[model samples]
Target: MLTIEDCIALSGLNEAEIEAISEHEHIPEIVAVEYGNYLMHSPDGVPMLKRIILDDIAAAEQRNDLKHALHLRLVLRHFIRTHRDLHKVAN
Candidate 1:
């Protein structure tokens, strides 16, 4: 079985990204790890992950959680850099 750390390492997703996913989706870290792995591997998951992160950022903004919002934006930017082709077109 894949550990959360292993999945996280393989998924190319940062800690903040995973945490945001967990918080926004009300999922546990281990489940978030699996979801992150699925997102990294699936053909259509990257953009979906991006959208999720963007939504999280917006939610953070609404709550005035500037730190979290900035962190999510950074995560999304890194995701874009690593998976440039995945986000070729803007949503």
Candidate 2:
């Protein structure tokens, strides 16, 4: 059986991005790995993933967790930089 870390490694997403999906979807990290992987391959899923990360950042700020909020912002920045579709959306 594969460990959660193995699943994450094969999911083509970093731990932070997977955690954001888990937070936004109310799913476990392992489940998030599969779900996020599915989303990465779907045309609509990329934008949805971006929105989910943004929502997580907002939630972190709402709870006054500045450190976590900042971390998520960095993850979001990295996410945007890596996803070409997002750049098109931004332009």
Candidate 3:
């Protein structure tokens, strides 16, 4: 059977991204992994994932959690890099 780590690896999203989606959508991490995997393929999906990361960053800042905010920023950068193609069409 596949483990959570396997699922996470397959989803191509890091734990931070998945956790943010779970918190934002109030869903389980596993479900978030499935969603992430699905979104990785759909054109609208990456944008939605970007929105989730942005929301997470805002929440972290609101809570005065600078460390987490910084981490989420890194995640956002990586997400942007990984999905650079998706953004190119907009430019």
Candidate of highest lDDT: 2
**Model 3 C-alpha lDDT versus the unseen true structure:** 0.87
Q: Runs in model 3 with CA error above 4 Å?
A: none
- Put the candidates in lDDT order, highest first: 2, 3, 1
State the lDDT of candidate 1 residue by residue for 13-40, as single tens digits: 8777788778768999878877887877
**TM values, all candidates:** 0.82, 0.87, 0.86
Model 1, residue 27: what's the lDDT?
Answer: 96
Clashes of each: 0, 0, 0
What are the lDDT figures for the candidates, one per model?
0.81, 0.89, 0.87
* Residue-by-residue lDDT tens digits, candidate 2, 23-58: 999999989999999988776777888899999999
Candidates 1 and 2 compared: the better one by lDDT is 2
What is candidate 3's CA lDDT for residue 81?
90
Task: Report how far off residue 24 is in candidate 2 (Å).
Answer: 1.1
Off by over 4 Å in 2: 85-91
Identify the leading candidate in terms of TM-score.
2
Residue lDDT tens for model 3, 1-91: 9998899999988887888889888999999999999987776787888888999899999999999999889989988897788756533
